[model samples]
Target: MPPRPRTSRRTRRSARAYAILLPAVAATVALAGCASTVSLEHAEDAAAVECADVVVRLPDVVAEQAERQTDAQGTGAWGDPAAVLLRCGVPTPGPTEDRCVTVDGVDWVIDESDAPRYRFTTYGRTPAVEVVVDNEIVSGTTAITDLANAVSVIPADGACTTVTDPADVTP
Candidate 1:
């Protein structure tokens, strides 16, 4: 009798399982690729109630940061956090800058990028707010990471969530 080839039961079982699952894995990947959501071309047709469109009231962090900035700049009074966030910082690249305001008790991040993901912490409430600048801010952002730790100016009330968009928007 000819010698039989050596084979393991576990190996046969593994091969059978892989053959059965290969098609399923491939189909799942293909479906995921096709299920992506695309943004609308015209801004007018888009939803008017975007996070950027609405500038909710800034909490303690943003308020205090604004006050500190005002005081640092030798200004008498600190204006509104939203306005100050948009107009306060010196003009720079990316146009997707960040504006934070802290009024001693409360503070919130004011990312000028897409969704404007900001965070606030106060005695009564501690919630995060992502403030996007309607059409101005695209789907991405333009700010450096670790801004809170990198820049001492960021108050303790605030914390960095995500990295800022690159300085340049590449095609």
Candidate 2:
């Protein structure tokens, strides 16, 4: 019988490398496709120049949640199930009874009516930015703080002031 040719050690190593690497590459591609696209609506001023700036400046992660792809412009999302969502260009909110908190130098009007799911809208910034956070998965404070730099690009025209402040009172 004719002798079979022996494979070289270098060839064997290359084959083994591919054997281990092929599956890893395939799994990564599969998992990436498995991530569903987040659906969102653009705000009234979504096309504003300031909104584009905010969207471009958004961080890759917020509150430990990795950012996700969104279906709309001037919008951002994070987490597998979307623990935090941001929309730039929402109508700038006016004085309200809702609780307001400042993170960094930016002020946010917090709506806690929904409890664990809270809506935070940037106050006093033109072409306002709005962020909705699922407090159960990530702290709203952390998410808002992470976003402060991006939202700050809009520039503040106003701020959250107490009704008791005499100078802030408007007739």
Winner by TM-score = 2
Worst 10 residues of 1 by lDDT: 68-77
What lDDT does each candidate get? 0.31, 0.93
Global CA lDDT computed for model 1: 0.31
- Candidate 1: segments with Cα more than 4 A from true spot: 1-4, 37-124, 129-171
Q: What is the lDDT of candidate 2?
A: 0.93
Please write out the lDDT profile of model 1 over residues 1-171, one tens digit for every residue: 999998899989999999999999999888756533322122221222321222222232422323212212111112232222222122112222345444333333444333343321111122222222232222212211211221223223433334556776576
Predicted candidate 2 versus true structure: per-residue lDDT over 122-154, tens digit per residue: 999988888999999999999999999999888
Clashes of 1: 27
TM-score of 2: 0.78
Reference-based TM-score of each model: 0.25, 0.78
Report the error of model 1 at residue 165, Å: 45
By summed lDDT, which 10 consecutive residues of candidate 2 come out lowest?
161-170
